[model samples]
Target: MGSSTGTARHSFRRRFTIVVALVAAVAVACLLPRWWCGRDADQWYRGDPATVRGLAEEMVAFEDDDDRWRAGGGADRVVGMWGLLAHQMTALGLAQVSLEHPEWRDRYAPVVTRAAVKSLLPQLRSEFTSSWHGRDGLAELDSPDGHAYLSYPALALGMARLVDPAFPPHLAAQHDALIRAFERRLLASPTGLLDTFPGEAYPTDVAAVAAAIAVHGRATGTDHTAVIAHWAQQVRAVQIDRDTGLVIQRMGGDGRAHDAPRASGTGLAAYFAGFADRALAEELAAGLFDQQRNLLGFSAIDEYGDGHSGAGDMDSGPLILGISMSATGFALAPARAFGHREKFTRLYRTTDLFGLPLRSGDRTRFATGGVIGNALLLAFLTSGPELAR
Candidate 1:
């Protein structure tokens, strides 16, 4: 009986050893890719010419393929919205690069123009209309009734015009019309808040409207100071959350919060507001920075502030242990723009680990990120205060 007990103990020990070895092998397998991907985090945050140029080459190829718009994989409305965002971000990134490196302007101009044009296509608007329950945001531009979401395409067009002074005349006129429409609606509104759809107002979208108007002013020398100032003052008084200093995510048409103050909205709002009002942008950036979380030399942003908790929505992407993908991704823009190099580097490591980027001869694209994801990363990584300059 004693010999049998000894044999049982030996069997248990062998099983435990095998389990330990398996666990160690799995850990190394997981960490190896993360370590390899993070090696260039600093270079990405610094906007290395080789890295930026390689991504640009990939974006140019993406724009050349007409079917790329449908690659997002969802309902038709989701596809359209994602496609529009992808094209808008692509155009903005290319335009900013052209402005920063004039030597490359000629090479990128055509792609930028194509992206801006595609952003305003009728099919995209049709999808938005369906999703908005027949709101037809592109219609009634002269009316003060809502539809502030149209500013997205307008912003893209303004960026395109800045890069290519000889933009198509018809599109240039459309861009001007959108700026004037937004100016009229904003000045006429009592609350300085405009609905993106009927009864649905988002401060982030309003911020984009303000940015589009500001960019139009930059590109065409139009004066939009008073309207922009009025919107800023209104946001300062009502939309900002006193506890966290982050902008409330959504509001009613009467300027009351419909949702809690959150990082995803605040981060993107900070980026859009930078073009119109630097002070306001800085304030939002400060609030967003307070919510940063660092673990093992990697960084992410919390979707909710202290004393707040909620589930992830379509905008926040997903919440993994309270770290929001969208919030972390969008925060990179403000981090780069505001000169937070260490923060940017750490956050980028997180992006690279999950992004699964694949590089080839003078070209790189994130394997897990389709066209929209790649376009957004391009925009966020290349963003800086110099883009406004």
Candidate 2:
């Protein structure tokens, strides 16, 4: 009996060892590609496909903080604007990720769809609709500080349609209204330098207006190409820094440029520029890419060392001593699309190895800073030709 028991124990030990080895092999297989596809992670960065794939994963995982449904109460609950934006973006990114890496599609599709509903669908149908209160039409969902808050949602609606044709029509209609509202706010001026507030004005608003119009054009097929062209010209006139070919942030109503070129503005501009003017877009985006150092710092100038220190804004998400990976992701996608191949590849490869925050089962999330904006960045990175193109 003792001999029999010893033999059984030996057999169990052998089985356990085999299982351990198999598990280790699987883990290595899963993680090896990511390491191999790592981006440069220094200054003047470029991007690569493998690295881009990893970035997509990073963007994909960036939606974890938006899991506030339980915290917000339940199904009909909502996380504020920022959180809402992230979830929408995450969903869009996941859907796009599904298309690119079909191996992961089945796993991500439903999750992305849910994330979208959690983020945008409810808001569009319920809160931001014409039926919303304010005693009828006295106070509509106006632009925030002249920035088209509707642009992201409009982009989300358009993306939803792209991902799933069966997406609701009301969402599309809401998107259309949002675009019209943007036109009313920004396009009122011939230069298209949008006012942040309805009556308040600024030259930097041109870039914002241009961006919103471009997104609206892309999303709804509204043929805003001419409108976008006008705004693009205005954006160039206002945001372009002649000294370094970098795009500046925050210009005044009197057409004066802000202190310096910011990562957020340059990154955001790159997207519309890629679609409208690749050459100029590349020039502007090139200033943001850092190839040799594997780092994409926040500002083109004045952000070196401890010069600029701060975080938590609607534009720049949680700057780390000034290295804004979130802004880097924003700039990288458009830069790649606009033929900044070297810069694109460097950004892609270097950003791959790090910045993924969580992994639940096969699902992952980046969740670096803001609850919502990160999700939108993920969506923007994942969806459309950003990764595919």
Candidate 3:
């Protein structure tokens, strides 16, 4: 009996050893590419407009067919709306890159404007309702918490104005109507900050919508200072992370902070805050970097770097030992905008390693990300003072 028990123990030990070795091997495999990409991505990556536009054209080809984007939902509820919006945001980013490359104007400009001029919102609303809110779906635009979907149309119009000076008169009218709808939803919020869902809100959505508002104002020479001021004050009083000064992730309808500060949410808000308010954005970005990122094998953010752990959700993808894949990827935008070049490069390296880049002829994109990953990358790579300027 003793010999039999000893043999069983030996078998268990061998299995455990193999498991640990496999885990270590996988970690090394992932990090090795990141190390290489960090040192060598310059071969394919650059800050130039034409270079970025090349990626945009690829994204356009991969994402759009017959002037329509693919549907954006699956088992993951958050992926649906976020994935849907990514195409538009990619279009918006493509337009931003076009600012420096007039030759590429004909490729992405008309496409973005067409989606805005047409009606993608109703489809987005319907999908968002079914995927997230279930079969009942959202009944009214104001009632549901998704005003940020308007951001793409707002930004597309903004970009159209910058690239194509002849920006269609009818499209301009459509832009005005969209702004009114946004204003109506903004007014519908019980709190000054916009709601992302009924009775629940995230400051990221507010910042994004505020950015669209700023962009629209720039495009049309409209002043929305008063609304912005009030909204900022409201966010400060209720949603700003006291320790980090970044926007808090989740809040109740009564304007009470719900979750701890999270990088995935705070990072995106800081990225957009550049358009609405730059100084505050700088502070938020700096604080978020100091707070969340752990620079071990590669720079990665924690789901809640403040003594919390939970299962991976939509916002915070696959959390492993507190590290978030989503936060690490999405965190790039604010890192770049805040001038954290080292941190930004680290995050980008991580993205490059995980993103699975695919190239066809002169164009390249990360196939694993589909449009969602590419759009986020496009936004990050193109991010700077240029959008706000």
Q: Over the full model, what C-alpha lDDT does candidate 1 score relative to the true structure?
A: 0.83
TM for candidate 1 is: 0.87
Give lDDT tens digits, candidate 1, residues 1-389: 99999999999999999999999998887777557757887777777788789888898888866645456653333356787898898998888778767889999987898889888876776755876677665666767776877888999999888888669998888788888989998888777788886777888889989989999998899999999999999889888899998888888989877889999999889888988898898898899989899876688899898788888997888899878878888888888888888888778888988888899898899887788888988888888787432
The CA lDDT of each predicted structure is 0.83, 0.51, 0.66
Q: Candidates ranked by TM-score, best first?
A: 1, 3, 2
**Model 3 clash pairs?**
145-196
| Winning model by lDDT | 1
What TM value does model 3 have? Answer: 0.78
Error of 3 at 55 (Å): 1.7
Q: How many clashing pairs per prediction, in order?
A: 0, 46, 1
The global Cα lDDT (0 to 1) of model 3 is 0.66
Q: Which candidate is the best by TM-score?
A: 1
Candidate 3: where are CA atoms >4 Å away?
A: 1-35, 39-46, 63-83, 115-121, 127-149, 184-191, 292-297
List the lowest-lDDT window of 10 residues for candidate 2.
297-306
User: TM-score: which is higher, 1 or 2?
Assistant: 1
TM-score of every prediction relative to native = 0.87, 0.62, 0.78
